[model samples]
Target: MQSCRNCPCTSRSRARTATARTQRSSRSCVTSTRAGSSYRWTILAAGVVAQASFSAILLGLPAIAPQIRHGYGLTLTQVGVVLAALNVGLFVTLLPWGIVADRIGERAVLATGLTGCAAALVVAGFTSSFGGLVAALAAAGALGGGTQSASGRAVMSWFGPEERGLALGIRQTAVPLGGAIAAGALPALSAHISLRAAFFGLAAGCVAAAAIGTALLRSETTKADEHEDASPPLRNPRVWLLCAAGTFYVTTQISLIGFLVLFLHDDRGVSTAASAGVLAGTQVLGGAARIVVGRWSDRIRARIVPLRQLALALAVAAGASALLVHASLWLLVPALAVAGTLGLSWNGLSFTAAAEAAGRRRSGAAIGLQQTFLSGGGIVAPIAFAAIVHATSWRLGFALAAASPLFGYALLSPLAERRS
Candidate 1:
């Protein structure tokens, strides 16, 4: 037995086992080491840039929807289909991207996705026909959905529990900020340089973001960073509740954003540029509200409480805006601003909660699931809102938008009680 232990074959086998153990330990240590505060903020910055790129391109079209319709000689419903196509692409790919993020990490996913978006946007810019435009936008959306889960998982994985709410909140602000940028620039660009130039500009932004993300985004080598757990995200009750609530919440936001400019122009005689400006203001205010509400949740050490409050506030604000649907411009603008703040502010809170409930290993998949439902709402709401306006009136459409948050609030209340 002693001679066998000393044999050359036995020695080689032992060396191989020892080498494997050392490699695993090195990887485990890499993953477990807490990232510095600055590094976490860097992750936030990268995520914001990536998210903003996706939002700017996707939201840019809506800001210039009027120009697209005029150039293509399409009706309102056809315009809605154009907008929905992008989200339809997102809905189709979000889950698969999340699963890939979990397996491959965020760095490759974000860079590749943003780069794909840049390419798709460039193609979209050159397309002459409506069918070509829809196909290109849908392709952009399918690729861009990669950023949603990858960027979200970055914040959730990098920050500790205590600081995640605020971090995620700051991250969430990028959506509205991107929309604000589009509102401020895209419509005017389309007017002056041609719609193609506006699209090229969006593509340029995505290219810049892709470069930044590739340079800065790091893979999580930590077990907490990339390890798979036995439990699937679909099995989490809290995740499902949050997803349902997000569906309703996002429906209201998309409805307002999708139609706000047109509503102001058609109903109040506001110019296209001026109406876009009002929508921009709503987006800016909504972005600020997300930051404030996120910090509020962090201080309270509770997620659902703030979520409940925001949903209620959104419902009330939406109702008030509906009442002002045709009121004085002075009344309507402020009301929509208030509605936007309330309607768009709850996303970070819900996202943070879902991440917590999902645990570190599953954050990517969980966020992906929630986003799928949110994108589903995005896919449906624009067409539905356009139909309602065509059938009954803009008043009915706005009223229905207002009521959406109440249903979100109702779905969330029980979850809050359970968490409490």
Candidate 2:
């Protein structure tokens, strides 16, 4: 056989092989980059679904308060207690869950917690006594608390600073979206079948979300990096200030979300279905507003500035709703929708601020601490608002609720000025 080492044909064939290999390598690199870019969005979708699922239990339970009260033959105060039970559970567990997420991983925390929450909701569905129902719901809240920190930490790890605001905003929409789903479905389900059916429906959602989140979520950090030293969220005054602002903001949110249906139904004589429809509409609007505000924050490259502005707007809108309480249904509905949308819009900004303040490694803890304050507000708002309504009137109660966002705005001013 002739030696062909330097043959011209052989040279051409070798060159062809090299070019083909280069092309294949380039294609693989592009494919990898595309997959990485797209996968973050998939992670975001999973987080949204997981949060929304749990929110159904947290916020949705209040939507069917009438059924719960009637079924248990409870007073408004007792109804407030029942509604607050879930927040009490959340308050107890949020920090611990956050610490756990920072140590382990988002996937494990979200999957395990959501599963436990589903089981707890099932227990709630089956329980017949008032005390048993409260206990079951609180258990669900405690377990579901993991979703808040883990899902947020996942977003912070996966997305860069430039995109974090919009990403968190979209993620935050899960709250109103979940509430809307619950408000729209639970009342009708309870009215037609039973309140137990409502609880079962929420359980089904949690189970489905757990499965989806488990399949999609993963920790973006290495074991060592995840445990890296960062500013302690507890010691950070900025974080505490953010927490205080969030606490006040949530009171307004709960006042509208937890009681709007009741107010319209009892005070205005609107049918339960109609009142729930308004609430559902408000939630949808709020979700859309979050997306818009999030994008706006990204454009401005500032979170607290817009947050403070929105707080003022929320205060005004809420006050307007209070004033319009006895106005025509057409007038009152639109005003409440604006206020509710404003109330729901600021959360994503605060979430982004808290995570950035703590650095990515400790984002979970910061978010947890912030959410814990908000949960405390969630616990108190219903009871206080209910008491105010019981003692004086719904109009006065709503007027007072409007002041919460103003307090939040004031708390956020120093932060906003520093950012400016």
TM-score (C-alpha) between model 2 and the true structure: 0.90
How many steric clashes between backbone atoms does each model show?
1, 0
Top candidate when judged by lDDT against the true structure: 2
Give Cα distance to truth, residue 28, candidate 1, Å.
Answer: 13
Q: TM-score for candidate 1, please give it.
A: 0.89
- Candidate 1 backbone overlaps, count: 1
lDDT string for model 2 (232-319, tens) is 8999999999999998898998898789888888889988888888888888899888889988988888888998898889889999
Off by over 4 Å in 2: 1-36, 222-229, 417-420
Tens digit per residue, CA lDDT, model 1, 219-337? 55455544535377899888998999899999988888878887787778889999888888888888898889889988888898789888878888888888888788999899988
Cα lDDT of candidate 2 equals: 0.88
CA-lDDT, candidates in order: 0.85, 0.88
